[model samples]
Target chain A: MLFFEGSEKKIEVVLQPGQPSLRQLEREYWQQVVAKANATILSSVHNEECDAYLLSESSLFVWEDRFLMLTCGTTTLMDAVVSFLEQFPADSLAMLSYQRKNEYQSHLQKSSFEQDVTALQQQIEGVGYQLGYLDGHHNYIYHLDRPYQPREDDATLELLMYHINGDTAQYLRSDNQTLEGIRQRLNWEALLPGFLLDDFLFEPFGYSMNAIKGDRYATMHITPQENSSYVSFETNLEGEAAALVLNALLKTLQPDSYDLISFNQQLQLDHQPGIICVDQATQPLSCGYTMRFSHYLKPPSAERSADRLSL
Target chain B: MLFFEGSEKKIEVVLQPGQPSLRQLEREYWQQVVAKANATILSSVHNEECDAYLLSESSLFVWEDRFLMLTCGTTTLMDAVVSFLEQFPADSLAMLSYQRKNEYQSHLQKSSFEQDVTALQQQIEGVGYQLGYLDGHHNYIYHLDRPYQPREDDATLELLMYHINGDTAQYLRSDNQTLEGIRQRLNWEALLPGFLLDDFLFEPFGYSMNAIKGDRYATMHITPQENSSYVSFETNLEGEAAALVLNALLKTLQPDSYDLISFNQQLQLDHQPGIICVDQATQPLSCGYTMRFSHYLKPPSAERSADRLSL
Candidate 1:
């Protein structure tokens, strides 16, 4: 169960005309939430408005009255949301999506479904949708009406997750030399021209990552564990998806297989023949947010053959 | 609205101990079913036992009474299935999967579900699944429990499809000289190495392809129609998962994003961190068949911005 959660949750609190400093609210929330907040400023604006912090698991973002937090692994995220809301009024908006691997235990199943549901539902009248296939659940998405949902047609969020298998995953898990090879393959500074990145590798399990980019941050988290390794390329900004960046990421990740999710304000995929995209649901959720989950698949038996060969 | 239908409908008619030749049955079915049937032999050992045929928007296969047929576009498939069952006794197996873009109309909506269901139910006992999202429907998969499902653990089949965008599509669509450039980029004869490939391009809206490497094919179908084009790479061989082909396909297809589905006789993905595979359902369908799907997506907003910039 080496699956890492890629789901996201946002908390948007509207402070009255001249309410308490957002900086004060953001600071208090982090100090109370993150266990080891060896917070390093990756990059940010002058007033720390569009700021990003790399914590134990992933990140914390603070921009004006809006604070967006995302963390994977077994991080105590829901409680952090509940705690921070004590200062803000019940009118605050929230959009939470917590997704993990088929093998990983869900935070929702950890007896927090009703509790967190109560917490967010108590604040805004929005509900949550538990999405996944019959074999196992993929993630949980929760969003409120007003401030949390995108008002503009341009603001779109897309996350691409890759599960590297065969030689690519094996090479990365070989040793330090492989890590160096991957690092050289990336050449991040040259490939991702403008952004300042913070890079590191996790011990024992060999998880290599870069919690990066300028104020409008993007990240590359690679769990380079043998047989169970994964690489995730995520960005919230429109421009982060430059041509070179996309090419460089694909070459580096070299996953045996992958899946795509498009959370657009209202955009739908242009038509293409010969390529089959299995759409999960393109309609808006009960709460008015819309997203499309489409996938191209490798025939199912390949994994079993690989397993037999491995044994 | 660019989507392709890769779903397949395999009609397996089990004959008696001394029934008519499966070859004759296969040919009779084809001439009466698929139009024109511009038959070309890719590969097979001695007899046309394990063969693959390309029709006008459809394909036919005959492997010792385990006949499998697949069709995309506005194909009269179910009617074809019904006509052939006349000569043979009951107890046939059917596995049908035909899916398209969100904007494309579902063949099922045209009142074909009951016709096909009745056609199959008239002979054998099986069911179907309507898989896709709100923007458009995708595929229809059907199968029977007794004869078609593999008892051997080694059996597996997989297909990889990509909705290619960016320069790859542009270069291929530019002109004949650019087609030469793309051909050089592909270097199929050199890259594919083994069997001879049959390559061709369609008129009006260009469709370039290569179907090679014996009966176990490695086909590349490129519909280079700007903003509405796709490139599909499909293979069923176990060793085809080799890294070279994967790299070559990515380099040639150069898709902005893509997804994959692996259909296994009994394969479940090895666990990975961070990646959450939304299982449609883990338990074997009533037919005792199983498959796994994975994806790699570009965040949605980027596409919109790209669309706007193009404007």
Candidate 2:
């Protein structure tokens, strides 16, 4: 199978006062935005708080005052962002932040961080900051400097995982795997509790899901092929809820390493057993948000040595 | 320019008794070995202790009891190892090791580590190991077991750097760059001291060099493109001297991150001022060698924040 870039490009925008609720916007409008990014809306779900899209490449979520859209593969997310801006009055934009995670195969990307920044600058001026090392797990962020208010409860945690292992991973690659099978294996009832979930399984391989409850949301995208296997879990859940889900999923997937990015100090991950935080950085953005990036790695097991002997 | 896989595939084999010193093997014999790996020999140099060849893709070094050959790009170094084994009796193999660094573009590689291990298994039984996280900076090693003697003084250090920056990186990419200029830029006088150096500059932009002193050897290869830029410094030198060279090169190249692998505990690096060791592991290999792998990252600087603002 051809390698897929599971790392995503994300944009979150908070609208100014008097603007229509983003959830009121028609699905056709959102579909155009997704199309501009060169992706499609496979399906979607909504609750009182948000409209969540299960995208062909990744996902999108919309709230009354804000909206988030993320796409993977070689989709031109900057193009989508630019097209999105054209639909709204420039004065209606209270805040705009664009982010991209460093890819395992950056050469396959359609645009570099610099190129994206250049594209974003054409519509709105923003400062770009890089968190962590350029050679390793890092994030590129461009934040537009519009007036904005920070919500006490506004927070987001994104966990991007790589090289997943174990029976769960094997099952993910198996022909018999199903969305319900994965939900059972992951035990979403315990991990996500009351949150509602919407998910899809792709032909040959791959999976994507969106879950919503009140104003809280959680989404997951899994690319389980060997060599380039990856899984990303993201949530707007706060504190212990976020950490609990993080631990539970990690226990199930057992990725060799993962990069965690938190916005607004929502997640304070306590030390995880068997996993060590390898690299971390906290940067306050010009866009009025504090961002923290941490990379965690599981210790190489002694069993790997024994397994190598059998090989 | 297309991205080059700067990470290397390496093999080192020790010969049994009554065998010809690898250094005494004719240049044509080494040429065939390089050819088998699908790389061309660019130049060569020798000292009393070793013979080193600068290849189109990387470098090779030959010593009396053992020889180390490393080639980058998509070259299949395992094929060379298999061919080299044919020239000698199976009993003449004292020990063998084949290693591959996790590549930025693994899908572009001719073979996976598993495939290479399978190929090697056709010749000899060897224990395979994965050092460090498979998703991050890591190494795969397959070591063939045979009668072997471990020497207290036998040690090797390899520093693989990525995403290098600063004037040195720019100069290396510039048309004005020359071998002598790089020598002065890196300050080999302080780094290698008594070592005799031989080097070459590739067309467009790239570099390869070899250095030797008595029974010790060092080799360097540079791929100085933007997205996939990489440089590797390796030496059989011991202790503090090795650390000194490592620090000096880091100062000049200013790579954002680097992976250091030491075999037989040849180097004990003290704390570096601006860099942090993000990951570290020590493994005792079945091939009578202890290997230590450490990944270091320079902290994101305040200056980077300011630089982003200017952009």
In lDDT terms, which candidate is top?
A: 2
TM-score list, all predictions: 0.43, 0.67
Which parts of model 1 have CA positions greater than 4 angstroms off? Answer: A1-21, A24-28, A36-49, A92-115, A130-139, A147-156, A166-168, A177-183, A206-214, A239-244, A265-276, A285-289, A300-303, A306-311, B1-311
Number of colliding residue pairs in each model: 50, 0
RMSD in Å for candidate 2, one decimal? 7.0
Clashing pairs in 2: none
Tens digits of per-residue lDDT for model 1 on B240-278?
343455555655565544435444533333222222232
Ten residues in sequence with the least summed lDDT for candidate 1 chain B: B302-311
Candidate 2: residue B153 Cα off by (Å) = 2.9
Q: Give residue B290's lDDT in candidate 2 (0 to 100).
A: 82
Please give the DockQ score of every candidate, comma-separated: 0.02, 0.16
Chain A TM-score vs. truth, each candidate? 0.71, 0.93
DockQ of candidate 2 (2 decimals): 0.16
| Interface RMSD (one decimal) of model 2 | 6.6
Query: What local distance difference test score does each model get?
Result: 0.45, 0.82
What is the RMSD of candidate 1?
16.5
* Cα lDDT of model 1 by residue, A1-311, tens digit: 24444333333333434555556654545666544322223333323345555555666656554555655554556666666666665543334333222222232233234455565555556544433331211234555544344444324344443455545456656655444566566676676666655555555444434433434555566666543455655554454354345445555565433444445533233222223333243435543356554443332332221111010
Best by DockQ: 2
